[model samples]
Target chain A: MSTDTVETIRTTVPVGAQYAPGSLLDWSEALVPGDIVLDERVAPNAPWSAVVRAGDVLTIVDVGGNQSADCLMFNAHDTSERYSVPDTLTWQGNAYVREGTVLRSGLGRPLMTVVGNEIDRQDTIGGACSKESNTLRYGHHTAYQHGCRENFLAEASRHGLTSRDLVSNLNWFMNVPVEADGALGIVDGLSAPGRRVAIRADMDVLVIVSNCPQMNNPCNEFNPTPLRMIVTRNEDTVR
Target chain B: MVGARDTASVLAARADARAQGSNVSDWMPYLPAASSPFAPEGVDPSALVWAETVAPGGYTHKVVARGTRLRLEDVTGDACAHVLVFNALEPWERLNVADTQKIPWQAYLGAGHPLLSGEGRVLATVVADTSAHHDAFCGTSSDEWNVVKYGDAAPQGPSPSGRALLTLAGVKHGLTPRDLPPSVSFFQGVRVEDDGALAWQGSAGPGTYVDLVAEMPLIVLVANVPHPLDPRTDYVVGPLRVHAWRGDPSGPADEHYSASPERERAYLNTTDYLEARGL
Candidate 1:
């Protein structure tokens, strides 16, 4: 749990400088399902991108529900310092994460804080998907299922990370409950058709994700959807 | 006929019992009885192997895993099990609608019944349950999964079709993105639908459960990977005897019991190979 006394302010009030719809451009066309979009104003992955200063709000919107977005965050200055899920859970004292949980780093430091949430926050416990796995679980015959692994590999290419960098991830919009018997369950989306979660970068962080495109189960009801991103400048910056 | 008052009274008692968590079977789905915790011999502790051979568009047994094998008899004949394995370790991997489409498996498997994965791996096999000689390629759906080829023209009861079974498997396995995998169905037959329209046909039945063997150790991982490719056609692996640990002074159980030097040497080399790879 963080004890740092930081004044909180709402950017929605007083009409903060908004990244208008048209003004905002996706590097990829139309932000379709299974695509990754990063705002240029913030730090990018690898070569250890510069730290995003305090009060920077990052918004990731699931254009639809039941779509999973894997996320990972790291300290900009310290390479080893990374996000800690256990600490985040303890900090909130609640298993479910919503608008207001400040994600702590592995070093017990604040990395990013959930500023605003338009949808039900997802699971941090579930990890990402891959291919060799695709073959092993399903029979060898249906081996070519395109999934999040391909997405991460594609995205990681830009950052110079091969398979090594792929580690545990946060399945945003995914809901997993730990049962009394210590069993884990993947529940349906509590998020509506269209939902979004916003986080303020405490520092320049490296985030990676694989917009999950799995059709095997009802997590997405076999229909992959899209997502949008918006970065808003603090209201004080405008006036 | 039991009068309306009697029926209503019974229903009320059943509901009250359920609300209090008392076990009752009046409203239970297709099963002889509520699953019991006790395991019978020749069966695995957490799994049920089906005996009857099912075809495309066919379904049997609502719940079958925890300690019994519901062997499909392949009643009508050869069929395919277009299955999807989920994660009992992490239930969130159970299934995803958008993911299926985004990955384009929805289109590829829409009528073809592609298997899903947690962490991206094929989790189950879809064995045919109906007789239409359905193409080995299409995927299955929910609402539009209307064409069911039954043995006889009886009342069209809503049974758990291949699609429903896939969903149930996802729930049972606690599937998630991490446990994800591509899937294949057994006794496959069906034409691919360009627009997702399914054409039913003849299929295998009774005495078929894919006879899937677990390649992994953990229940969570085991639950997600579907059954193996048919042994008759595909390359088959082992009926391996696993020991509690490596380097046991007794060696592997089989070798220890048989006192076979050859088996002991095989175990030693395998251990060395694994250690060399840092696995």
Candidate 2:
């Protein structure tokens, strides 16, 4: 046998949950007692949307390991000013989104701020997968497969948004690294089961989430899983 | 397998044709000798390498050398020029619109801003701009959306979509549809309001133009199509005039090279790469 050895660089490993699905009542450690307002589990390859109130916290849980959650945000009052990847990345002077990063809007206003993070990084590039891109990247056989763009369209349509309203979005738990020569690659995720990140709404924002259904790339490890979303409101700050 | 003899004869004929000069004109560099009337001021007419007018709903692709300045003019008041840029040496390193907007710390692109790459290098710089109406947020129009808006969105049909046109342009360069990314649009504008609403600002007027100096060998693709946000019922657009001339790339001595710490780093990254390659 050859003396060469292959070394695998594993970025993510299974981690136990800090707050399991049935343990929301015990989340007083993070939020005040009885502050849990909404807790919903989004199925794999599904789309979820909700209006996260200003000052409220929305926690996203990677229930199943290596799931990519493609997300878009807009000002709840006016859907026109949406999440701006350029503003967010430029103002932060960083490519990856992490704890303490303020997600900015196209108007250069803060839409949400990451208060807690468990994963190493998040993606601001690596736009949501679409049928056209899927067909291009894979082949014509995948032209009709459901994609994140369709999920976004289906969810956004409920709010009266059209295809023209879609914008480049954020990818939580997705690992997209830019090489030294500026080659963008969507590789395996850096998120593990039970890992979570929490964001506080700086304004009343409409958050849309599409658990990425991309089976063509390693971003989902060829197997997508469900995600959990929990909204908590502080009693002391309730107006 | 069914027609082995015919296939062999066809291959022999193709080889014979290749041995001659029959395939010499398969693809030729677009090096036009004529000068353009719309060439911007300060551009030497003698140094111009290409000049052409792309019809409405048409597209064009060209690989320009480093330091080549490209001027795109809206001949009519309703034209939207959707453009994509890629490093000619390595097509994988294309324009990163997010980095382009963010690194400059300005969401609204104008003169003096550099189009950055994902690896923190300056691919091109907006040396001159008169049409302040440009968009870095919304990309080009899609075929499905175009079909919904118009009756048809075929690449050869009337009212061609920007994505379809760009795809064709990419195909001409041995690139597939996946090579196309979210592009930056010029001559049409969209601004976010105080209430977080995106407001569409149509073209400024005829003859409005924007100039870009390529900091690296770049494959630039442009599609002159109607803005997706345009509220017009008809697929109306105007022709786009393109002019390119040899120019000097920015260096450490340039004022824009040190405009900001971020920009300085990007410029340094670009220079370092070029120096390493002895280019």
Q: Report RMSD (Å) for each prediction in the order shown.
A: 19.6, 16.5
lDDT of 1 at A200: 75
Report how closely model 1 matches the true complex, as a DockQ value.
0.03
Residues B1-279, candidate 1, lDDT per residue (tens digit)? 245323356777676557766554321222222232222335543343222212233333222221121222222244344443333333334333223322222222322232333333222222223332322222332222222222221113332333334444444444322233223333333332222223333334433223322111123211111122122322111111110111112224432212322223323432343346552
Ten-residue stretch with the least lDDT total in model 1 chain B? B237-246
Best by lDDT: 2
Estimated TM-score per prediction? 0.39, 0.56
- DockQ each candidate and list the results: 0.03, 0.04
Residue-level lDDT tens digits of model 2 in A1-239:
21113243564543211222332121112322338888887766789999999988888887666778899999999886777775565455466788999997755578999988888888776777766455434555665676888889899999998664676788888887654323455778897777788888899999999988877777676766677888889866443
What are the clash counts of all predictions, listed in order? Answer: 141, 1
Error of 1 at B39 (Å): 34
- Could you give candidate 1's fraction of true interface contacts? 0.03
